[model samples]
Target: MFLEVKNIVKSFHNEAVVRDLNFSLDAHKTLSILGKSGCGKTTMLKIVAGLENADAGTISLGGKNIDNVKPGKRNVVYLYQEDLLFPHLNIFENIAFGLRIKKFPEKEIVEKVNAMVESLELNGQETKMPHQLSGGQRQRVSFGRAIITSPSLLLLDEPFGSLDAGTRQRMQEFFKSLTAKYQITSLFVTHDLKEAILMGDEIAFMQSGRLKVYKDKTDFINDPVTGVQNEIGFWENLIPGKVERETLRK
Candidate 1:
C-alpha cells in the first residue's frame, strides 16, 4: 500500500470528528471521499497530511510509519478550500518554492516547474501575481505548486469548492488528465458526487467519520443502503435519470 490509515480517531473538545477509520491506497490511483458538510471529510484528509494528529491510530506511507512525521517531512501536500499561494511570489516562484526549500538544483527546478505550469495550463501566467489572476487560474497555480514537488500522496481539500460551476467542471476534467500525467496517488475530499465518480478509480463514501469503500460504478450506485440502493441523482445532467422510490405493496 502506498498509504495506509488505520483505526484513526480525532476529537475537538469533547466531540469526536473522526471515528475509528481504516483505508489504504495503492500507487497511481485516485480515491475520492464523498459526504455532506461537517462530516469530517476535511478532518480525515488533514490527519493523513499530518497537519492534525489523530488521538489514536497510525498512518503509513510506503511501508514506513508516519504517525509522528511532521507535515513537511511526510511529503504530503495539501490544497485546501483557499489557495495558499504567496502574494509576494509570481506564479513560477510560487510553484518553485518547494524545490527551493529542498535545495534542488536551479536547472532541475526550472525544468520541472515549467513542465508543470504548462501541464496545468498556466503557461503565460507564470509572471503574474496571485491577485492578478482569476479564481480558476489561481486554483491552477495552487495545483501546480502541490504537484511540482512530486509528493508521495496528494491531498485536495475542496480545492474547487468555491469556483463557478462551469470553471469547476472544466478543472475537474483537467485534473483527471493531470493526475495521470504526474502518476501521483491522490486522495480527494469533495461534496460533488459527479466529480468523485469522474476522477476516482475507486470511490469511498464517508459519513460521521466512518469510511465505506465501493467496488465500482455499478456497486457505488446500486449497493444496498439500508434496504435500497443509494441512488444519487446529482448526475442527471450526464445520465438523465430520476430517483424513484419503490416500496413493496402491502
Candidate 2:
C-alpha cells in the first residue's frame, strides 16, 4: 500500500463521525468511496490530507508515518466540488502556482504548465481568466493545477457533482484519462455508484462514517453487504441494459 489509514477516528462537537475507519490505497491506483452526504467522507479526506486531525489512528504515506506532518508538507492535494480556481490568475498561472511557490525555475514551470494544459485540453484557454471558463473548463483548470504539481496522493470529494450531466460525464472520463496518464493514486469520494465503479480499482461503501471496503471490483459489485446489488439494480433501471455490462467490465 502506498497510503495506509488505520484505526482512523474523528468526531465533531462530541458526535462521532468516522468510527474506527480503516483503508489503504496502492500506488498509481484509485479507491473510490460511495456514501451519501454527511457520512463523514469529507472529514476522512481532510484527515488524510493533514487539514484535520483524527481523534485516533495513524496515516502513513510511502511507508513513512505522516501523522505529524503539516498540511503543506504532506504531499497531498484535495480537490473539492467547487473548482476554486484563483479569480485573478489566468489558467496557466493557476496551474503554475504550486511550482512558483516552490521556486521552481521559470523554464521548468513553463514546460510543466504547458504540458499539463495540453493534457487537460486547456491549451488555447491558457490565457483566459477562471471567470471566463465554463464550469467544466474551470474544473479542468483546477485539475491541471493539482495534477501539475504531481502530488503523491490526490483526494477528490465529488469534484464532478456540480456540473451538468453531460459535462459531468466528460469530466469523469477526463479524470480517468488523466489519472491513468499521470499514474496518480487517489481516493475519490462520491455518492454515485456508477461513478464509484467507473473510477475505483477497488471500492468502499461508507455508511454513517463506517466503511466496508471490498477486495476488488467484482467483490465490490457482488457483495450484498455494501448494498451494491441495489445500486446495480438502480443503474439497470436507469440505463436499461448497458450499465450492467459496463459495470462488470469495470
| Every model's TM-score | 0.89, 0.93
Q: Clash number for every model?
A: 0, 0
lDDT of each: 0.84, 0.91
Candidate 1 C-alpha error for residue 120, in Å: 1.9
> Judged by lDDT against the true structure, how good is candidate 1?
0.84
- Model 2 C-alpha lDDT per residue in residues 36-105, reported as the tens digit of each score: 9999999999999999999999999999999999989988999999999999899989999999998899
Error of 1 at 96 (Å): 0.7
Top TM-score hit:
2
Tell me the lDDT of candidate 2. Answer: 0.91
Which ranges of candidate 1 are over 4 A from the true structure?
224-250
Off by over 4 Å in 2: 234-250
